[model samples]
Target: MAASLTAFAAAASADTLFGAMEKAYVTNPTLNAARAGQRATDELVPQALSGWRPTVGVGGEVEALISTQRAVVPEADELVDAVINDEAVSGNLAIELTQPLFNGFRTVEGTKAAEARVDAGRQSLLETEQQVLFNVVQAYMDVYAFRQIVVLRKQDVAALEEQVRASNERFAVGEITRTDVAQSEARLAESKSALVDSQTNLARAVAKYIQTVGNEPGKLVYPKVVNLPKSMQMALDAAGEINPRLLAQAFVEVAANSDIGVARSGLLPSAGLLAGGQVSDPDFTEDQNENASAVFGASFSIPLYEAGLVYSQVREAKQRASQSRIQVIEIARDVRRAVVESWNAYVGLGEIIKNTRTQVSAAQLALTGVQQEYAAGTRTTLDVLDAQRELVFSQVLQVTAEKNRVVAGYQLLAAIGHLTAPRVGLKVPEYNPEENYQRVRNKWIGTSVETVE
Candidate 1:
């Protein structure tokens, strides 16, 4: 099944937008790094839950004592004294356990904060995915458009070459001045230089395409115009609700609020259960003695003061929550602005594309008429050169306008947070952030993690 899917994907990569997007979704390092970051974030819940679990510790100690002492004894009214040496060894082994029963609701609030942060991290991952896809779109269009421009420039160079040859022939026959031939030669050189510039741009575009899409671009198919919202107001409304950055910031604000709760919890009392067992062996004179004991009890603790540390922490958390709320408002404003700008660009490019197409058609006819007139000695050589230049400029404009139109449409979609792999109908499997979160949220003990890859 995997082989068949790979074959199908290979077949679909012949000049397609969805193919590039799908490849980027599966293989782009930027997207994959974001995925890994989010997966790491999934461990936060387990970390929080560990607060409710028991902690166990085991230890042993051995010690040897040596000393010299003077001993005195009284026997029937007579005193006696002697020097003595002493040596002793002792050993002890113990195990202890503690289980949290309560912690001033710190654990509860901490768990809530961790969960909120996980939510925020998921949104952040989505935002990263959106950006990766948007970059792919722009890079793809750039390669396609610049590649076409290079072709047009090559054609222009060929036409100018022909003009130079014709002018040399006329000069040889005394029908045109040397100045005309030189002019044609200069124009040909300029056109060739322009071709080189176009080639350079194409090279840069190809590099970007490879970086974003994780593959060298193939011959790209002409992209279809994207479907947009009916009006600018609709686009703005959609962006306001769905823009990933804005949503992520809103989640961050919630997490920050939860942080305040977690900080406040530090001021309250805590309760736990403690249990232990110990065994010890000691040597006394000629006899060995051993002792063992078991202990279990409930424990409670209250915080009275900490040099105002907890209070300051609570204050800091409140300030951060306020900052987060303000950030949400700022992101909303930026999203609205992006929607407006992208909408205008998308709309404006449509008219420019239409106009440039008409210009190309008219320029082609004008150039042909001017060349014919020059051949008949009814026009100057300069007129024919001007007409050819105009035609080439129009062609360049047309290609650029088409490229901008397509790119602007994609930008509008991105601004509205609709440029997702699923929405674009990419054929690759999608990564589910929640799946990893669910798998590890309550996990008790483990080093290995379940991953999408």
Candidate 2:
């Protein structure tokens, strides 16, 4: 199955937008890095969950003591040494446990905050995916347009070369001045230079295509027409509701607000249950034996004063929450602005594309008439050269306008948060960041980072 998929991908990437987008979806380094960052975020849930679970630990200690002893007989007048030296060894091994009963609902609020952050992280990953896809779209369009422009430049150079030859023939026969021939030659030189520049642009575009799509493009197929919102208001509405960055910011605000609760918990009382069992040998004396004991207790603490640290932390959290709330408003306004700008640009390019096509058609007709007039000696060499230049210029504009229209449409889609892999109809698996979050959210132990591909 993998081999077949690989073969299919190779064939598609050789000449299509879908293949390029699919390849970037699976292999782009930036997208993969963002996924990894999201997985790191998913671990926060498990860390928060640990607050509600008991902690168990095993420990052991060994000690040795040395001493010198002396005694005085009560009936005797002199003191005598009763013991020269004494040594004793003691060891203890224990297992201890603590389970939280309450801590002013800190765990509850912390878990809520963590879950909210994970939600925000998922949205952030979506935003990153959209960015990568949009970059691919722009890069692909640039290379395609430049490649077409290069072809036009080559055709222009060829036409100018023919014009120069004709001008030279006319001058040799005394039908035109040397100036006409020189003019044609100069125009040919300019066209050649333009051809070189076009080729350079094509090369640069190829390099960028490789970087963004993870493969060198073959003969690329133009991207399919995107589904656009019906009106500016509709686009704005979609962006307001679904724009990934805006949604992510909203989630961050929720997380920040939850943190206030977490911080306030520090000022309240806490309680926990503690239990332990120990096996010990207290001394090495012959009459001594090992002993075992068990202990169980509950602990409670009330906050007195700690230099006002908890109060300060609570204040800081509230301020941060306020900052986040402001950011949500800021992001919403930014989204609206982007939607408006992208909508206008895309709509304007539609008319531009139509106008450029009409210009190309008229230029082609004019060039044909000018060339016939030149053959009949009714039009000068200069007139023919001008017509050819106009035709090529119009043709170049047509190609560029088409490319820009497509790119502008893509940009508008991106602005409205609709340029997703599945939404755009790329034949690839969608990345589900939530799968990783669910996989690790309640884990208690071990360190395995393997998540869904």
Candidate 3:
């Protein structure tokens, strides 16, 4: 187990988005907790089966006694029948068995309810896995986006500093007013402050990423480009059908419906067969005889009244089933809203990125022209400084637009429920409750954790 965890940690540090998602899929505490709860639900299956299977038990007892007896008679014929001091010991043993004959289908309904619970639990786990994967993707993209901003901010600061230097030269040569030099210096300081703010954002993103993935992301790689579906309606349609939250809600409704059957079964009679044998000895003697006997009998329990408890329970189950159905409709509406909101945000950012790219190209060309003119003494140093500042601003906008585009894509995927273990390229571990339950359910037991290779 240690080796496997170590390998997972290493893999988690390899990429910015995918790696964190994969690690969280296996190692996140919340997801593990959900899995544990689901396994607990699985035990109900065997518990329900018990109502149909035979129960057997063995028991033995031993006793010892010492006594003296005296008799008194009212007439002359009465005499001491005997006078004695004796020690006696006895032992008794028996095995008993009970099997269900009829149970008004209570056992069958219980089993069906248990199976429905198992299904609900499995869906809940899948929903939890989807949530964890979404969190990892968001954090990873946050780090990537902020890091890119930090780089662009640094470049902006550098460009502003060069602009300030050019303004100072022009002021010395009397080619431009001192006001231009002061404006340039003020802008440079603002650029420095922006760089500091960008660095702080980047640090926070990295910290969040580390917390989620359980390791620092080292030498991060760009996330693979995920192609959006052809249209927003297509994405919404796909999401409405496959979303884990919706699926989980559907299963909850199923479990609630099954509960109604279980509650109804409680109103009927139950029947079972029972058998037992026993042997007893009055005293421990040189010659001992063993006696054995067997008998089979059927028992029934009729439910006459329970102060309306069964009826109340049935009413409650029906109400819960109705509530579950309403929840499914609510979840579907919420999912649709999320799909539309995320899709719009993604498309808006894409447009900004495209426009910013064009602005950067225009600013770069303008800066080139200003540089040539300044070198030939045809333009003042202030002109060159202004052109360079515009170029730096354009570069910053382009970087921000790119980051926004990527982060929006992640959000869109999360909204659609596609951000889950298998969808995000993470392996899901298999869990078997029966195997673990059999190991500890019926025996005197202790537990220890051991590493699995």
Candidate 4:
């Protein structure tokens, strides 16, 4: 569908960052795969729940026997055949059921662990969604910034061209020297080369834009990243509370600890109810006679020795649980670092942009004054060229600063785990992974597909 959505206008492009985010939320392959993975994780709950349910099976078997025997009676002084040949065929049909009554609380703990894992899976998907959306933001911002740079480069070339023409005209009128004209021409050539480089950069940016957003971008509008934390402390708080990566790891720790209980349960007793009904006949091919039977009983077992298997498993689970606990702290530290870096970048770039704007303003005024002085024969051609160069450089720096500032804002939001479809209000359906999870969490005995890879 995105392939078919190749209309590259802002109108066709969905025009704004919100629109791009909405498109990506629905179409991005990475995000969709994460959703599918979470759905699979949801199945674990039902599987664990099945431990509390009954398993039934119906089966049958057939058998045939053949024998031959002969006996001789010595008293009668004669030999006689008693059982020369005998053949018999039999069949059996049975249905057996087993319902677990208790398993040392393994089912309860196993289900708890599975549910925690499913929760962790949901958090992981959230992180993935945040990542995909952030990438889209970065990609589109790159295109926008480069497009602005290309425009500036083109304007520089045009200004240099006009200066060259003016210098030549003054030289022809005996008002400027040949060296002055040559200098103007050289600057014009450099500007053209710079323009070419900027154009190439723009082309590369466009390619990346298409790859990221699943369509060529046209007429893109920069949308502001809203709902940012007002201070560093606020941001840190948000990261601690809602950062998906950190939360996912915390859930993983919980799941691991719960799994320890499941492993320990293996050392305890298990009990179940068993029932069976069967029918038998003396012949398999032909029914000569039949016998029916039904039976029900309680089964119980306690592990006496298992070659240290259960002990080893319990120890392994404990180690994993310890590792998971450490991982949660590790990931929290990482999230905090990301938040600090992104916050600083966002805050610092704002100041840099303000300074660059002032510089651009001064450079533009200086260039215009130099041009006027040159026209009045008070400034050299070199003076005019230098002023023009300073103006262009300042303008380029200003554009770069502005681009960085906008992107940094988004980066901060992403770092704190808030750059998501709902937060941005992208005017599209928010992907509720929970919907699928809820639908399938209690599902039994049906296989239905909702999407394909």
Could you say which candidate leads in lDDT?
2
lDDT of 1 by residue, 281-335 (tens): 8753434488899999999988999789999999999999999999999999999
> Which pairs of residues collide in candidate 4?
none
Question: For model 4, how does the per-residue alpha-carbon lDDT over 1-453 read when each residue is reduced to its tens digit?
Answer: 675566443355455777777788888888988888888888989899989989999999888899878776454777665656778888889999999999988989989999999999988988898888888887888888888888988898889889999988999999989999999999999999888988898888788767767888868776676999899999999989998889889989999999999999999999999999999897766765888999999999998988999999999999999999999989999989999998999889889988998999999999989999988999999999999999889888988877777788888887788887888677887777778778877777789956525
Off by over 4 Å in 4: 1-14, 63-89, 164-189, 374-382
How should the candidates be ordered by TM-score, best one leading? 1, 2, 4, 3
TM-score of each: 0.90, 0.89, 0.76, 0.86
Instruction: Tell me how many clashing residue pairs each candidate has.
Output: 0, 0, 1, 0
**Per-residue lDDT of candidate 3, residues 172-194 (tens digit):** 99877888788788878887888
- Model 3, position 408, has a per-residue lDDT of 71
Query: Considering summed lDDT, which 10 consecutive residues are worst modelled in model 4?
Result: 4-13
Cα error, residue 274 of model 3, in Å, equals 1.0
Q: After superposing candidate 3, which stretches have Cα over 4 Å from the reference?
A: 1-33, 63-91, 163-186, 285-293, 362-397, 421-453
Worst-scoring 10-residue span by lDDT in model 2: 72-81
lDDT of 2 by residue, 5-37 (tens): 997887665667667778899999889999999
